[model samples]
Target chain A: MKPKSFAYVRPDSVEEAVDLLAQHGEDARIIAGGQSLMAMLNLRLVEPSILVDISQLKELSEIGVRDGAVEVGASVTQARLLAWPELKARAPFIALALPWVGHFQTRNRGTVCGSIAHADPSSELPLSLRLLGGEVVLRSKKGSRKVKAEAFQQGLLTTARRPDELITAVRFPVGVGAEGAGFREVARRHGDFAIVAVGAVKVAGSIRVAVGGVADRPGLLELPAGGSEAERRQAIEDFAWELGGYDDIHASARYRRDLVRRLAPIIISEAA
Target chain B: MRRIERDEIVSVSFELNGKRAAGTAQPRTLLSDFLRQTLGATGTHVGCEHGVCGCCTVMIDGVACRSCLTLAVQVEGRRVETVESLAGDEDRLNALQRAFNKHHALQCGFCTPGILMSFTDYLGRNPKPSEDEVREVLGGHICRCTGYAGLVAAVLDAAREMRGETEPEGEPHAA
Candidate 1:
């Protein structure tokens, strides 16, 4: 099937893109790698009147470590990040999760910001971001604002981003004074969306966890510091309850909950 | 960095199989359609019409990507290698194509072009891949026929040939 005919534009700068988005609103769709949006467009699931191509925006192509955080420009593809020594050193979770995002080819064209913006409950990037306490930088014609990854992801395929805002970049706080970190996921196929994805970062005294694909949004949990094995077991069980999993074609709600119950310890143990 | 107004004609020019090809497409025109309709490069087959099936896979600037998931306009200045890029002359078959024929890696031949384009990129990067790694890459592709036993052999054989190694005498079976 062909996508409905629409206009396409590549803005000279982030501001110009924001103005176009602001002017067009719902009729406009921001396109980066086109890995996700193109699927929707080809299926006619989303038929925007305009597609703003940000892939060529040089301003949004930088990946750097600054002020204790790793900043990835909106146009930076996942494959590029996977090869970046700085990102792997500063934010180890990204390195661990990227290969699981999609196949090698999709990663070549899929942007990190696009993944975060897609906000799929099954997306590995956002699950990792939420666990690491990242921030999304959104710009509008008026100005820019930073929203925590937690607050930005609203629900399934939904985010808090306003219609007029364009995601310019994302900031992930690099784990410091950390003991270890690990990421794991189970998909029917190697590159398919996960049945459940877990990312864990163990710091000086405690374990932090984030889970995706079991609910409308990824769930974050901080287990109590330094507890007995039983206490930790109970803590994980209690945390699992908060996920609000629902039945879907992939797996039942109980199965997803069971995955969290089982995988939580293995990944936490790996990170530890 | 550039601005295009609504419903405006966007001329896209890119290297298609080592030759310059240019076309005008609506923003919605997919690269798969561009190759078939504009350049008459029908060798790159389209299936599933989405990213799930690797039937529309092509080399975009040397990376394997789904042509169905890419707009024709997006190939503006990139190099796209379709299945047509494989063989040099009408009489000669490329090493990969020959290996596929020898190993019986394809049936119905619908999935061959996309698989070839994909491996053209994959085998270049991983000239030596373990069976698991080959299987891992194959996970992205769907093949109802040949069961991939033959495809893996084809890739391994092609890799050896690409490395300038001569095929050992007699019907060679993948070890």
Candidate 2:
């Protein structure tokens, strides 16, 4: 289906794009890769008056190491991020969940920040980022601020981002100590959005489990390191209660809650 | 809503088949529709408009993208090559296309173009992808027919043919 008519602006610089977005305010949308926004537009979910095309903004489509952390530009495509050697070594959880993203063709145009901004509860990237304690860098004409992934996503398809702001980059802390990561999700079909997805990271002798698709937003649980099996089981059960799963066409709320109770311990055990 | 006037359609210029081309497109027009309906390049098909099905896949600046999910105007000044441009004007099928035919990889041929474009781009990057890598890359596509065994074999066969390990035989000519 065709999308509603809108004005298009291809901004060559990030500053120009930011200015355009600020001018358009809520009526404007920044499109990078256009993988998600295009689908939404065609579905008429978002009918913005102006589409600020930031694909040409070279400054926003980069991946590099800075201060011992892998900093990925917001426009960095999922395909490129998976192929990035640094992400594999520095942020292994991101690497593991990259393949589960929508098939190869979609990943070619889907951006890392775009996924986070879209804030799909079932999306692997956002849950992985949250588990890794990633921070999103938001910029606007006024100033720039950083928000942790945990606090960034407020609800399903919701974020802390303002209408005029743009997500410039996402930063992942490097260095590993007792840190292992595992990602598991169940979907009706390969490449389909997950019915339930879990990402776990063992760091600093503690295990962090983030559950997606089963809640309004990704739910995270932090367990004390070197815990007994009984303690781990209790933690998993408690985490399930905290998750408060919701029912959808993919799975029932009860089913999701049960899966979390079952999957969290498994992921945590593997990561531990 | 107000009617969209003709002047509202913007002229988007891009490189198609290595030649510069321009077209008037509305903001809502998808690249796949623009190619097939507007430019008469039927090689790119629309399977799932949501980008799940790769049937509308095309090489945009060497990366496989679902054209049905890409806005035509967004690709201005970029390079786009559909199946029509995979082979040169000489009418010779590309090695991947030939391998697909040689291995009988397609049954209904509905998802062939998208698969071909995706695998072509995959092999371009990793010329000798292992069976597991082939599965990993091809997992992005969904083909109900052929059970995907022949598709995987076709990709492997194409890799071998590209490396001069095998000769093309009884290749299915594009219909």
Q: What is the lDDT of residue A220 in candidate 2?
A: 84
Report the number of the highest-lDDT candidate.
Answer: 1
Window of ten residues with lowest summed lDDT in model 2 chain A? A172-181
Give a tens-digit lDDT track for model 2, residues B28-111: 788999998877889888886877767889999999888988888878789998888777577878888887887789989989
Model 1 lDDT tens row, B17-39: 88899988778889999999887
Model 1 chain A — which ten-residue stretch has the worst lDDT?
A174-183
Per-residue lDDT of model 2, residues A187-220, tens digit only? 8876888888988888876888899988788888
DockQ of each: 0.67, 0.43
Q: List candidate 1 stretches off by more than 4 Å.
A: A176-178, B1-10, B165-175
Question: What i-RMS does every model get?
Answer: 1.6, 5.7
Predictions in order: lDDT: 0.86, 0.83
